[model samples]
Target: MHENVRTLLDTLELEKLEENLFRGTSPDNGWQRVFGGQVVAQALVAAQNTVAQDRHVHSLHGYFIRPGDPTIPIVYEVARLRDGGSFTTRVVTGIQHGEAIFTLSASFQRPEKGLEHQATMPKVPGPDDIIGQEELTTRILESAPDAVRHYWMRPRPIEFRPVSFEHYLTGDKLPPAQNVWVRCLSDIGDDPKLNAAVLAYLSDMTLLDTSLFAHGMSIFDRRVQAASLDHAMWFHRPFRVSEWLLYTQDSPSSSGGRGLTRGSLFSADGTLVASVAQEGLIRLRQKSQPDV
Candidate 1:
């Protein structure tokens, strides 16, 4: 397995401190705060450990209460809310420094037959046709901004091939939508719970950036203050994170210093495996005045 992927898996494996409590740590990569996705994934893991193995997570809703301090460990407290014949519910709270930093509620259900329908996947070039992140970074290394360059240069567990690189290159005000092909760098075994957690982690990657498309800005822009306020995901079908999946995203509205974005994750074969919705803080910072 790729070292980064192994690291990611290790990060997701929380230590069972008690029956309903778990502890997780963050990678000491140079980040000011913990990634929101990591907290979400870890919290899900905590909840999953408490539920029966026969049940699989079908949906999760989370809120970011405070910025997490990456230097310390986060303690997750899971509350077993209900355990019906076919469904189970768990609520998890991520705590750090004696305060709550994040909270998530997840629902798990047993497999059962049901009527289902999904929207057709958009027709777009396959992942192989699009430029990979490494090559794209090398192509614009000298010209790209430091933030953008650093982002592409970082070693990530997941890889992405975007449908278009024009927005990142030119910062042109474009439509508030994007499509990116994503997959784990290494094959994570077909564990339903693990795959669901990984999917939740990947869902947060570019959803917020979709909102910035209309403003010709990106989260990397120093003038923009970006943070995920809340995240919600619904697992519609089983999916393997190791395989390429198309992440189609769009921002429907941006107002009151917040932007709402929605996303769908489709397997390479065009199966809609999951849906995600998130609203984030996208306030712009005022430029400083030049010294007199």
Candidate 2:
């Protein structure tokens, strides 16, 4: 495991607090608020703790109610909403400072035969052809703000190879759609549930940026502020995080200071694995360019 990934897992400390409650700690990854993706992943882990190993999480929907303090530990209270012979459902609330910072509803289902079909994966450059996020960050660290260098620009445990990273920043801005491949930095052993949860963690990294692209904005330029308000994910097939998977994202709508983006995940062999949707806050800060 990467040093950072180990630190992150250690910070989470997924321990049982009560019969159905799990306590998750926060790592001060230099963010004032707990990361939305971490909260989602931890909640999924907590939900998994209460279910049988044969069941797999098929879907999860969540809302970020309040900013979670990264200094405090989050108490995840899992509610057994329903349990059937073949399906199990759970609702988990991440609480800090006596308030609900995040809440999630997830459903797990036992494997069963079903009609199967999925969109074919788009042709894109393979992961080996692209540089990892850390390498990219290191090259740009000299120009970044100290805060960004220390936190936002840190090494990403997941590797992402955009279809064309150079085009987004240099060429004519394309449409909101983007295609990229992602995978874990290290082998994540044989736990499908953890792999699914890791997918939940990786899902939120760049989708909201697609909305920014729709307006010809880049977070790198600092012309706007963005934050996720809610996230929803659906697991379509079992897949390993250790291998490369394509993530295709696009934004369809933005209005009243909010933008909605959706993404689909596909295995290298063209099997659709998951779908994700998120609505995030995007506030434009008009920039003053030098007078011509």
* Residue pairs clashing, model 1: none
Q: Candidate 1 residues 85-178, lDDT tens each?
A: 9999999999999999999999999999999899999999999988887678767655888887777778889998889876676678999999
Per-residue C-alpha lDDT of model 2 across residues 153-234, encoded as one tens digit per residue: 5566777777765434542466778888888878877688878888898898878878877666655546666778899999
For the record, the alpha-carbon RMSD of candidate 2 to the native fold, in angstroms, is: 4.5
TM-score of each: 0.96, 0.89
Point to the candidate with the largest TM-score: 1
Q: Give, for candidate 2, the lowest lDDT window spanning 10 residues.
A: 283-292
> What shift in Å separates residue 180 of candidate 1 from its native position after superposition?
0.5
Give the runs in model 2 whose Cα sits over 4 Å from its true position. 133-153, 167-173, 285-292
Each model's lDDT comes to 0.92, 0.81
Shift in Å, residue 247, candidate 1: 0.4
